[model samples]
Target chain A: MNSVFWTHLVKDLRIEWRSLDAIVSMLFFAGLVVVLFSLAFDPRAAVSQGIAGGVLCVATMFASVSALNQAWSREIRHQVMDAQRMTPSSGAQLYFAKVLVNFIFVTLVQIALAPFFFVMYNLHIAGPAWVLALILPLGTWALVCNGVFFAALSIRSRNRELLLSLILFPIFIPALLGMVQATTAVLTGDNDPWLWIKMLTGYDIIFTTVSLLLFDVVFHAE
Target chain B: MKKAAFTLFPLITILLMVWGYYQAIYVAPDDALQGYVFRIIYYHVPSASVAFCFFAVSLLGSIGYLAFRRSDPNKAQIADAWALAGAEVGVIFCTVVLTTGPLWGRRAWGIWWTWDARLTTTLVLWLIYMSYLLLRRFAAGPQMQTLAAVLGIFGALDVPIVYMSNRWWRTQHPAPVFGGGEGSGMKDPTMVHALLWNMLAWFCWGMLVLLLRYKVERRHQEYAELEAEEALASAD
Candidate 1:
């Protein structure tokens, strides 16, 4: 079962590598959004330590949606999901695998954007900056888990994006709130990011559990 | 005897509804804070309560359909009908909740709409049910039924989340507007009689709508079967 899961997981990643379209588009989209934000205000004055966190948080949300759309939507659209269903591993395994892949892809895009943002906005670099590292992977994991479920639900619908957003945005309020606050706290050296950290962990656990229990039904849904 | 019993239900329901409305309008205590506009509570609160109840009904119906292949088709169909009716009525009540809530909000808090957690969660609940109804219409056969049932269960899963998240997280919305586990179920003794009666009224109205829809759907099934038979006879 373990081998089967990893094989399936690796297969998804390789397919993504071959295409490269999703990662390229996501990075481009994130950059464009950041640039748009930059242009909206003077980069130096606009980078209100607080707003930088908000921008990245929103960018992460959009970037994950783009990546998940690429990863899940194609498999669903092509009816390859039926093949996945017949695999030896359980639906739970498949869901986690997809989430892992989505987490990595989205986080990498975030890392890529960090330097561009630093250069453009003249963000003051500070200690270790490595703590900011944990935020992206964990935050994107929660957000993409949500996006994957919605994407799966909306795959065959007439208005996919509209339906996806309807289901996706409302449920994500807590995660977004937590991530933005935590990111700001980290950047500005707030004494403790404990509250935001706990919120993110809670969101991740609740949603990951939900996705595991519910994915089989959603994947098999007509 | 069965026909008589059925008839009695509607008759009693009508009487209860009338009596309930009278109490709600004339008897319930006037809140010093909200004045008469708060009277919307009689209809709005009950509608919202029953709406939650209906979502549960739909969830149960969906579970029953999935678990019991041997159950009577009629039972399943009736359950489906009740579920649909409950959801439709639930949506209406939600609208009332949403509408009257803002009215109360504007009067009390001086804001027409605020991103208060409860308001946001309720809005999400409303949208989920709306999508559920649309999914039901678009789905067909056993597959459609299964899909609706799955969606129904998944959708209802959020109700607990909504209620709890408000409790656990930061929310501008106050404690339960109605039955928040205190104040003796009703704010006033007279209001109790009125609110119960109003609830009975809305429930009956919900039943009437359900039965009417069931009849319409039954006829539709019959018409389809007849059309199939006609096509077969014509072929023969």
Candidate 2:
């Protein structure tokens, strides 16, 4: 099971690395979202921090969704999932792997956006952008788990994107709420954002477990 | 049998709604703090409660689909239909919650909308239910049912987190208005009665809608199958 999981995981990673389409598109989308938000709000750094948290939440949502749609939809569309299914890998392994890949992609997009956001919004990154580095992984985990599950649903549908947002966004509220609150706290020099961090961590753990148990049904639903 | 069940539902719903209104308006006392407008809580709280009911029902239907361990197409279809019904009804109540919330907000907070906890959580709830319906639409068959079931369950799971995120993080949202009076610091009995009666009425209303939606959805599925068979026959 471990070998089977690793082979499929590596295959997916290699495929993503070679094509890089998902990451590129997500990055572009994230940039566009941030630009659009910046233009609309025209917020100075002082007033921007309040809404900046909201903006980052929205941007991260788009980035995560874009990456997830690409990652899951590509597998389903190309019938790559069939290959994974034929392997001896358990659904949990496959689910985690997908989450892993998506986490990386979303985090990279966030990394790229962080600098741009800093300049454009004059937003200061408290604690050298490293003190808050954990937020990316933590926040993206919640997004990716939900996204992977939705992507599985989308793979079987015609209007994949619309279907994804419709099903995923509503449940996505808490994660968005947490990230925004936490990010805002950090940016505003709140000294601690433990409460918000706990919220995300709790979401990640619960949803990850649920997704693992449910992935077999989702992946093989047809 | 289904039609009779369906027919009986609306009659009871109307009767209950009327009684609920009486209980809310005439029976329930006015509050000292917010007066007549607080009456909106009757509708608002009930709609919120019914939304919770819809989510729980949908989760159960989803779990049934997964745990049944049989390939009964009939069971699968019924489960999906019910899940969809719950989602639609859930969305309706979510809308009610959103609508009534702003009205309440305007009265209490002096603003049309606040970034407060209840408002944010309700908005998230609305989005999640809407997404659940969309996922169902996009996917088909047992897999669709399973995918949606996961969503139903997961969506239900998120409700508490969303509700608490604001309070835990100290965001500007209002704390939970109805907390069963267990150290929530909310001690207005009139408000409590209004919340309960209003919730009951909305639950009835939500059920009525769900029953109607379930029947329509089942028929809609039957019609599609019929059309497909007719096409195959004509081709033959």
Candidate 3:
């Protein structure tokens, strides 16, 4: 319970609460993607049920990237980065707070987009629904954790938006694989979902640790 | 003498490549099963081997850059040069492997691609390095090296997961051609010998290009430093 970490996290949450910018656009983008997916794919009950996981994960990914590219723009503006650099606290706290806040934002959009899964795709869970609680959060955390870090990494680039996705997507494939596979299994109830869930858990643990460790270096390197 | 060796290296590499081509095309005996088409392995496998090897070089260079950047900046710049050179050259070789792989696959497997672990992992590896190069190209400022090095390490971390994907799931990519468990997969001695020569030739050629690229990058770093100094001096 470091005060710095807690304060930073609360500040970001409060700021976003005031504007609702990240969540609003994320939800809208995700909703559109879900509908677009239905139009592109067969969308029959049988086909949709099987592909529901992939569509949901992919929609979340695209929507989150839209939000993530702007996650640090506020800090970059108004000399907030310079002020933050002068603080005695470690940079990891700020990085952690940003990830946590963006995670909450993306999760809110996923929640809002849930109804589309039912109304449009008619996706039914063949396996236990409880696993969705564990898997979706884990998947979203994985995306935000890496997404925020790479967004910062690419912030100074000319192709900042494109660079974020280019670097992030390849690194993210394994976790995406896990999320898609686990979700698909749950939707279909054919294969055991544990393997993919375990993989997601591993991915979250590895990248979260690395991002926290390297955050200071990236923060001060400028 | 140093200048002489620099010129001689490439000449030797070219001669070895010529010799390797002769051994591969004329001296080596054919595969009993697939016959002439199997010769692609000599070029294809060697190119892949070089790509993986140079990627390791790039990783080590990145680690070295981060290690020395704070304590010894001169050493860090040199290390960064190695990192860029290894990565760029590695990408070129990886491109060759990706192209030649499908060519071989089209003939051997009767398909251009599959989502098997090896093929998928190789594609992912290519994507990782390509992004690394892109970051180097697109990013600016003093922080660029630090960011690129961090990314290099992060990308390397994925390699193990990619390698293990085959074990966790069934893969259609053929098992290791040389070191699949109990014994060497190739039984024919001439084929092995020819493959060895080609491997040697490719390694020599790759080394030449890597060194050339490293020299170029080092010069670029020095020139950039001088220009920065000039700009600051003029500002003052």
lDDT against the true structure, per candidate, is 0.72, 0.77, 0.89
* Best-to-worst lDDT order: 3, 2, 1
Most accurate candidate by TM-score: 3
Q: Give the TM-score of candidate 3.
A: 0.97
Model 2 lDDT tens row, B1-236: 98897688888878878887888888777766888887787787677778878877787777776666366767767877887888888888789888888888787888888766667777877777777777776667546667777777777788888878755644654455755345553377755665666666667777778988988989987887788889999999
Worst 10 residues of 2 chain B by lDDT: B178-187
Q: B1-236, model 1: which lDDT tens digit per residue? A: 97897788889888987787778777787866667776777887777777667667667777776555346766766566556666676787678789888887787778988766777777877887887777666545544555566566666766555555444446676566455756434456677677777887887876666666667766775676688889999999
Off by over 4 Å in 2: A49-53, A76-78, A126-129, B1-13, B26-29, B69-73, B170-179, B182-205, B218-236
Give stretches of model 1 more than 4 Å off.
A35-54, A76-79, A117-132, A184-193, B1-17, B69-84, B137-141, B177-187, B210-236
Give the per-residue Cα lDDT of candidate 3 at B150: 92
RMSD of 3: 1.3
Task: Determine which window of 10 residues in candidate 3 chain B has minimal summed lDDT.
Answer: B161-170
Model 3 score (lDDT): 0.89
TM-score (chain A only) for the predictions, listed in order: 0.91, 0.92, 0.97
> Residue-wise lDDT of candidate 3 within A86-150, one digit each (tens)?
99999888999899889888888888789866788987789998999899999999999999999
TM-score of each candidate? 0.81, 0.85, 0.97
Clash pairs, candidate 1, are B20-B197
> What overall lDDT, based on C-alpha atoms, would model 2 receive against the true structure?
0.77
